[model samples]
Target: MQEAFSQTKNASAVKNNYDRVAWFYDPLSRIVFRNAQIQAQQALIPYIPEHANILIAGGGTGGILEAIADQYPAGLRITYVEISEKMIRKAEKRFTGKNTVTFVHSAIEDYAAKSHFDVVITAFLFDNFTQEKADRIFQKLDKLLQPDGKWLFTDFHIDKKSSRSWKTWLLKSMYLFFKFFSEVEASQLPDTTSLFKKAGYHAIFTAFWYRKFIHSSIYQKP
Candidate 1:
């Protein structure tokens, strides 16, 4: 309790913003993106081994937890990390599966002494941090991954082919809304694909959603 509180007290505005919107976060996603969010998430489920040590960062409202539990009834050790206390509470209630899951209400950057895992999942997580913070978080999580582990990443992407598309404007508008309400750090999406590649990770699989604005990808260090 002390540890969680200490981390929370030192967190950025994103924590408070998520706490305020924890109730509507899940519903709002469904209303705007319908099943697309879940669909994109589900795309990476097959990549997880039946029995594996997994770390899911920024696992908002337990959507991914619910999905993983439905697929793996046992032999799964998961550490779920999130910054929002209210969001953590919501995730705790929604997780009813038999898998061994630990919910930690701390920013991924603050969580320490983690075991290396077979899989690391970060969905809709990278979109919240600026370049420098994103670098720190990525390096932190990257170190927590096993040499041969799979990195499951799902986030908004920007492609030159669609640089001028409606999704671009939509992305801008969403940032503005989140900045005002959540005060998230990043003003725009980062080129995460390049971020991974530059670190020597290889993209094993990738699937797109919401007209290619969103992507779910599996990467590995080969």
Candidate 2:
């Protein structure tokens, strides 16, 4: 989750940024969010049907691969999409199960779908983008999902009602760190809940972790 990225036009910079931090991304995340990121992801895994086709976009360090593989030791295929070569290599060695996985080394924007996916997992992906980039990415992925497909989205959530709170300061500090470290474009998290609702994806389940700072939700394409 600590991996930073940018829009496609600046893919090289983002790739370099992610690669530079690939060694420390997971450790930094654990230091900051502890197990919240992991918990939020696992909360949505039960919704994935057996033999499902899954796409993991921006899969940092590929830690979740082990979890998904554990959930379905067989009868599952994963398309792991990432921009960083170093991260891809790390992810390649992370999976230790029977599920078939195909690693795609490309930005999500540059990723061409060979087949529609039954499940799309974009954990902590959107928080790195501005509203425009996030919307563009969302629209693209929205089209690649099969009907009745499940979209698992997990990211930081900040309440607009509370303009001045610890979460706001913490998020601001995080953005500053990411901006300095990875040239990330986002200064704040997007309004993800509204974005999903606008896309007409029906929410199947929602959960929060790390004191509600992190949100995980599964939506179905009707």
Candidate 3:
């Protein structure tokens, strides 16, 4: 994945776009998606072990870090990775004196993991890629997990059966907004559930927030 990300055509563009919005990301994100975001994080908290080695890929602005720290148990080693330097700096501010959390400023594809992590968290991260890229990236992420490890994922999903027309409009509007400001590669949400199943990951738990527009699930790697 590191190699693939290094070769990505829009890596720098994406990084720059996020950097441009780092200052406003926290506040805007809170106003727009805080409820669902918090709910998703809370759902995954119970699955994380006390002494686990965890990877937080594309954890923008460190909202997840703050949540984990509030209820964090001792002996857990967390490596938080974000591609935007400014975003990571904000995260760094939240954990100023904490030794258990290590921050890495790099794209997930370029990050070098010394060993497989017991748990991997990718909250609201996968929505930025196209289906094909998301599939490749998921494969790479799966390789970074321990054999029995679980992946805690949260992102937007547009369910045709369950979603209303207005919900679809809202999702599209949000995507267009991000695409202009963040250079988001995908104009629509990827079919993540299908990709996960194809990769041999089974959902151990799942939840929906905001009328099922936002989906959260924990998939275990076999």
lDDT of 1 by residue, 86-106 (tens): 788777776546788778778
Which ranges in model 3 have alpha carbons more than 4 Å from their true place? 1-12, 15-17, 96-99, 162-164
What ranking of all candidate models by lDDT puts the best one first?
2, 1, 3
Where model 1 places Cα greater than 4 Å from the true spot, the runs are 1-7, 10-17
Estimate candidate 2's RMSD in Å: 4.0
TM-scores for candidates 1 onward, in order: 0.92, 0.92, 0.88
Q: TM-score ranking from best to worst?
A: 1, 2, 3
**Tens digit of per-residue lDDT, candidate 2, span 44-97:** 888899989889998978888888877877888888888777788898887547
By summed lDDT, which 10 consecutive residues of candidate 2 come out lowest?
Answer: 1-10
lDDT of 3 by residue, 116-192 (tens): 89999998888888878788878889899998899999988777774557778877887888777777888777888
Question: Which is the better candidate, 1 or 2, if ranked by lDDT?
Answer: 2
Which residue pairs clash in candidate 1?
Answer: none
The top-ranked prediction according to lDDT is 2
- lDDT (CA) for every model shown? 0.81, 0.83, 0.77
